[model samples]
Target: MIQIKDLHKSYKMGSNSLHVLKGINFNVEEGELVSIMGSSGSGKSTLLNILGMLDEADEGSYTLDGVPIKNLNERVAAKYRNKFLGFIFQSFNLINYKSALDNVALPLYYQKMPRKERMDRAFHYLEKVGLAEWSHHLPSELSGGQKQRVAIARALASDPKVLLADEPTGALDSKTSHEVMELIQGINDEGKTILIVTHEPDIAQMTKRIVNLKDGIIIDDHKVEQIRASQYV
Candidate 1:
């Protein structure tokens, strides 16, 4: 479902250029749950940003679903991003004043979906994440796990083809983190292609495959016997 070949990225710092990703080659098939694992400065974030189309690679090719993702205009890129990608961030990126239901509905609203349809879809996803009862609660009123569940629901409300999570369980306690991972695993079981960027070994093990990154390149990529997050949750 996603492919990258010889990907290279760099940032300029005055007279020096800092290379972030180098000669990276990767592929993610439909319905696969994969984790990109790396330490600080290992280029996982750069790779995720490029995969999400939030940033452009300085070199190499990226094809999502089958369309070339190079040199597209901002408008076209935004359209593709909205149509094909969903994101979950560690920060829970919800508006402080919005209730959980409103937060989940916001993406559909941006798509110009009818109000009733959006609300229905939002509620459906909230229920999927086990947050239907918390729909009226504000982010401030919910626990970290609840907020992340709301974020997950928001990410799914648009029904995108790929889900990209950055440090999804980073902020929560071990129990809450496992609970969130259990939710993510359940989503993947239903055939959603999901990619997680995380440094935690246990978090990466929850995925079916782990791609280790070091020095801006993939050092190891392999599938492991899946460790169900429900065991811990």
Candidate 2:
């Protein structure tokens, strides 16, 4: 469902260019739950940004659902991003004043969906994420786990083809993190392709495969015996 070949990325400092990704290559098949593991300067974030179309590679190619993800004008890129990718972040990235329901509906609003339809779809996904009763709560009113659940619901409201999560459980406690991963695993069970970027080994093991990155190149990539997060929860 996703393809990358010899991807390269770099950033310019004062007078020197810092290379972030060098000759990176990987492919994620539909319905695969994978983790990209790396340290702080390992270029994992750069790779994720390119995959999410938030940034472009300086060289090589990326194709999402068979469309080349290069040279897209901002408008076209936003359209394709809405149609093909959903993002979940460690920070929860929710607007403080918006309630859970409205936050989930925000993307649909950008899609120009009718008001009634957007509201219904938002509530449906809120229910799906087990946050229906808390739909009216603001981000500040919820606990860390609840806020993250709301974020997950918001990400799924669009029904994008793939979910790109960066440190999805980084801010939660172990138990809460396990609970969140359980929800993520359940989502994957229903066949949504997911790529999680995390440094935690346990979190990585929860996924079906792991891609290790270092100095902007893949060091190892392999499938693992999936560890159900429910066992820990």
Model 2 lDDT tens row, 1-233? 99999999999998999999999999999999999999999999999999989899999999999999999999999999999999999999999999999999999999999999999999999999899999999999999999999999989999999999999999999999999999999999999999999999999999999999999999999999999998988
| All models, RMSD in angstroms | 0.7, 0.6
Which regions of candidate 1 are displaced past 4 Å? Answer: none
lDDT per residue for candidate 1 within 1-233, as digits (tens), equals 99999999999999999999999999999999999999999999999999988899999999999999999888888889889999999999999999999999998988999999999999999999998899999999999999999999999999999999999999999999999999999999999999999999999999999999998999999998999999986
User: Which pairs clash in the backbone of model 1?
Assistant: none
**What overall lDDT, based on C-alpha atoms, would model 2 receive against the true structure?**
0.96
Give TM-scores for every candidate, taking all chains together and pairing residue i with residue i.
Answer: 0.98, 0.99
Off by over 4 Å in 2: none
Pairs clashing in candidate 2? none
